[model samples]
Target: MTEPSTMLAIDPAAPGGPEVLVPVERPVPTPEPGEVLVRVRAAGVNRPDVLQRMGLYPMPPNAPTIMGLEIAGEIVAVGQGVARPEVGDKVCALLAGGGYAQYAAVPAGQCLPIPQGLSFVEAASLPETYFTVWSNLFERAFATEGDTVLVHGGTSGIGVTAILLAKAFGLRVIVTCGSDEKCAAARALGADVAINYNAGDFAELAREANGGRGVDVVLDMVGGDYVPKNIALLADEGRHVSIAFQRGPRADLDLSQVMRKRLILSGSMLRPRTVAYKSALADSLVRDVWPLFAQGKLRAIIDSTFPLADAAEAHRRMEAGEHVGKIVLEVP
Candidate 1:
């Protein structure tokens, strides 16, 4: 099959605000070897996408750059040596870039069949949050049954996914959200305890909720002022993983608490990792987690969906922080 001359995509004119994300036309990308061309139906709006737009996160080196991390669509064409998925198979993929487009070229190995009973919009929400949780919480942090896990930003996409998955795996979950309403939502989604970060100190609250014993794992995206508190809130041999530093990256803190508790601290950025790592993650998700989604034991929590042309509005909503779950852009 031949690629089309042009397709619709959202482009950042300059690193600034939502207005910078303007619609543009670009030539459809062809699938390279071991890749497949997908007709994008929807793309998830994540904080990383907003960071990329605001210059906090720079775009990967290229021109006519399109920014989106996850998409759900149909495979339209396959490149050399591809097998398994045929034309028109519905799939959701983890992409490095170019997801905010009419068509995207995705590594074939990173594409997963859309789970039963999920729409394109829902499927679009899975890759970034689910992959992050699966990789960090379960895979790297060594979270397991009977472990007590604490997740910050409890109402956010990552928080919700982590809460649900941990509960499903028989781990007690404690979470911190910005407001009581958000905490309620987190509890409804399976968190055993939801602390209002605006009203309480999360470190102290998590400790209180766990019967004086701190949680086994703490998944934190908020850094800076919360770092010392996070270290203080861990159980013996606990794990602390950071995926983002929304507050600030730099911290001046004492390490005695970490050593005293025998805690493990780690952080990861998914985008810059080698393709092989992502491919392996995708395979692991398919093998270990897809069954939960297929059985309806896990589901995507979508807060809103915007038209592809309204990508600017989507960014505005995300930046405002009212959304409780994943936001998506319908690409059509």
Candidate 2:
């Protein structure tokens, strides 16, 4: 079973639209020290991939230029200093980049074993959003049992994962969706409350849902004017974790609110973090969350999948905001 020297990938000719995500031939990455080469069966399509395609997302220094951030596949080769995940092990890994391809080289520690009975597509969908949600919503926000959280973009990958993780850990989650349909979807996924942002003021609705106390944590992706609104909804000593700013980066907020409430505002971009940090996160997920999946208490919710060559369509679906869960790309 010799690996191909070159693989089909979506490296992009230049920064542009979804059309730029065309498949092209690129040399398959060899596993570096402590890394493993995955024969990628599937890859997850993420917002950062779209940002990278448009040249909007800043590339981490010396990171791979390819447009994928997560992949699930089988280990075909291993690099020096690697142990445990030998050749032929199935894994899904959070990558620095280079996931939209037939093969990817990833640090062994970052490659989490696929949960029992999950397909490659399901496995692929886990890494990026799971890592992001666990780190920001659970770790950074310090959301514990019985706390309530306000999660924006209820149907988005990160939002869905937040809901599931919160439910698994006994947190009450209030999520904001763009439509009634999406809100219903979120409710079906165990969210304590789902508010359609277009319906009315989400902050008021979420506060009412939490018995007028507001949320202990806010997982915000929609930035800009929403920041102050989110801040207004926080309970005393609340934590706000920003994972994206789709609305815009700048925010006009009242500093007096921060002082009075002792709010903590924190944000993180997963790709820029060191391998050791991400690996530790992966380890944490394996220990704390993977068992839930294995026990059938949790499952990957996939909206759709595309062939590796149809990455453009995947991006378009993601951008359209019509999908309720993860959009994935399947490889040969």
Among all candidates shown, the one with the greatest TM-score:
2
For model 1 the local lDDT of residue 276 reads 85
Model 1: pairs clashing at backbone N, Cα or C within 3 Å: none
lDDT tens digits, residue span 133-181, model 1: 9999998899999999989899888998998899888999999988889
Task: Score each candidate by Cα lDDT.
Answer: 0.89, 0.93
Off by over 4 Å in 2: none
Whole-model lDDT, candidate 2? Answer: 0.93
Q: Pick the candidate with the highest lDDT.
A: 2
lDDT of 2 at 265: 94
Runs off by more than 4 Å, candidate 1: 1-3, 61-64
TM-score of each: 0.97, 0.98
